[model samples]
Target: MGAEQIRRWESGALAHAVSDPFGQGPLPWLRGSENYFDDTGQVVPWYADPALARSTDGGTRTADDVHRQIKGFISTGAAAPGEAVDFHITVDPPQQFSVDIYRIGHYGGDGAAQITTSPRLSGIVQPPPLTADRTVSCHHWWQSWRLQIPSYWSIGAYVAVLTTVDGYRSHIPFTVRDDQSADLLLVLPDITWQAYNLYPEDGRTGASLYHAWDEQGCLLGEEDAAVTVSFDRPYAGAGLPLHVGHAYDFIRWAERYGYDIAYADTRDLHAGRVDPARYRGLVFPGHDEYWSVPMRRTVERARDGGTSLVFLSANTMYWQVSLSPSPSGVPDRLLTCRKRRGPGKPALWREIDRPEQQLLGIQYAGRVLDPHPLVVRNAEHWLWEATGAGEGDELDGLVAGEADRYFPRTPLPEHESRILLAHSPYPDSEGVKRHQETSVYRAPSGAIVFSSGTFAWSPALDRPGHVDPRIQRATANLLDRICKRD
Candidate 1:
């Protein structure tokens, strides 16, 4: 059926002809007051309706029971307006299920808007994944359902909620991108998400780039991990990628302030479909750890072309990976990373003499076992203006997860000026004291590159109970400068 049939819009109102799993009732169309002009004078819909934030029913499944309930993945990481995307799903015990699509944004602090709902479709237990060369690929080859993206949908991050008749639910996230240019471009880290996915997780068939199951049904370390991974399988738990929340946090915060931003998948960059130089700034809002040659080249070229770049998390552009077609010849569907150089080649950017610090102004330090205070430095800088933060002021629990730091011995980017914003010390896994630094620098092209150096930065901007006004204001100052809104 067409999008109109599945979307089920009637008389300009959302038609809830299907069952309401969310119990949210009929959602209203975009109102006049909810529409605002972006920085580019384009009409953008504001999604701040408080009702949109109502929580969904059914708790997410833990790792142990992840696939026991229901799970699925999209044919592509993203799709454009009027494009057709396929959904491959598997429901244990063979039952009925429905798919509810929601656009993620700053919906009145509710964080999402129900775009549409699918009529219940029959579900079944798809066959197990095919394992070849240590790679577990679910060619799923199951009966598929197609969803055509409505032409009127806005460009942003979206998630499809899958619910069975018995109340079990899971999520499948994808981006809706367009050809229009905006002041800022937000790139989702889907490649890294696939890199860490250990689908099936049944202790007998799953394998990602990091770990795998041994012959005795025990988890193996990186040494025995898969050298390649496919996007054809669902995410292991709750069907959500690890570190995805960081991107969602940034989206809610940025759209809440009405910034002119567009969205794209990281693979979009790899294939050269989206040009970074077209926008004023490129924002990587999560733990984007993997990189391909084309992806790195494009961003580097954009930075030198005067387009600003922002890295909100640490350990970005760390691994060197390449994309190949799936066994069935689907282009760029398989990711390969040996993690070891072959014949004088290298698997990491640093090993090849082109370290990430030369571009980010900082490099990955180590993992943080516990959250620590983010000690402030250079409070007088424009990025920290109006935050009321001064030298040595510590933002509690602001420096957690993986972090990045400046290395004086490594190659640094050429810039007109450089400043260290935060210099905090924390104990590493070995009890050794190490320092983390947040930095910004102005390149010769007049482009500004800012790295938060901590995974906590994005969460602090929007996550409930984690939001800090100092961080919110400081981030606004930086984006305002980049988008020229200031």
Candidate 2:
């Protein structure tokens, strides 16, 4: 279909005029509800029924069942409006399947809005992945179904729900980006997600940058992990990347407040498609540990140019990686991280004389063996305003998972001012005492850099049973100040 025609179809204008095999129609909130649209007659902010989350049936039963049933990956991690994206799907037992597209956002706490649904299409089991040089890549030469993104679709993170005839399902996440400017840009850690993805984790063939199965069916550590990983495969298990929910949690909270924000993948940063300076602030919302030279350079340059930076989780920008093309000659399809220092090889950014603390204001210390309370420090700071938190006040279980801390001896950035927001003590895996310190600083360019210094921070914003009003307010305070929205 033509671009304009697709745009009209997606906007629900052509829904009444033509028969839509894809089931494109008015949104649930718009049916018999005129108030949902703005004065311009456009849908007001695009919300979904909260009941949709409870009713969605697109989850895989188990890891092994992922590939055995139905699983897929998009041809690209991010696409712009009017671009055609191909879906590479595989279904065993040769059945029929359909794809339900959803734009992930707040959506009235439903967390997603259904964009469209494809008709039943034939499904076939694709070829097995190729294992070479310790990399398992599914350069699946399977027939692909292409979907042209409608020009009117809002730019955001999206997922394609793949469901088979007999009730098997999986998900594929991608981003739709644009060149428009906004108050803040949320960068999805897709590179880190792919780094940890051990697709087809069936004990024998699955491999990631962190772990892989040995000949005796035992999991190997990083020393034996795959040196190269491919994006030509689906995510392991239910097709969702680990720690991706952290990004989603922040999204739900930020969108709930009606914050002006845009979205992009990490790859977009590396390719220079996204000029971080165009936005007032750049927010990295999850476990963004892996970094390529170009990615690091771009972000650092942006920060030096007076653009604010926010890291909501710890252990960011630790490992150095390199991106290359796939066997089919697609750029950046293969990610290689040697994790070892050599004359000319990839290694930890710290070992290369550039510590993460220089950019993040804190560096990763160690993993948190158990949950610990985050003790308030510098309570009078602007970030803690309206949070009702005082000196020594503790937020229970706010410091857990991985954590970061300020190192006086490490190379640090030259800043106009700096503050330690939280200083909480926790035990490492070896029972050694360690302290996690949340930090923030103002660079010479007047750009503010804030790091939560704990993996649990984002979860505290929107995750059920973990959300704390104090944290929610503090986060809002930070974003408002950086984006100048307050």
The clash count for each model shown is: 4, 0
All-Cα superposition RMSD per candidate:
10.6, 11.2
In the range 371-406, model 2's lDDT, one tens digit per residue, is: 799999999999999999999999998997788999
Question: Between which residue pairs do clashes occur in model 1?
Answer: 47-107, 48-107, 48-108, 53-110
lDDT of 2: 0.79
Query: For residues 1-486, could you state the per-residue lDDT of candidate 1 as single tens digits?
Result: 221222112211121111111112112112223233343443232342332222243222222222456878887767899997799988887898888888988776667788988888998887777899778777755755799998999999998878777666667889999879899999999999899777756666777887776666566777788999999988765566666777888999999999999999999999998877679999999889999999999999999999999999888999999999887788789998989723547789998999999999999998887788999999999988999898899998888877899999997899999999999999998999998999999999999999999988988887755788999999999999999988
Against the reference, the lDDT scores of all candidates come to 0.79, 0.79
Task: Assess every candidate by TM-score.
Answer: 0.87, 0.87
Candidate 2 off by > 4 Å:
1-67, 341-343
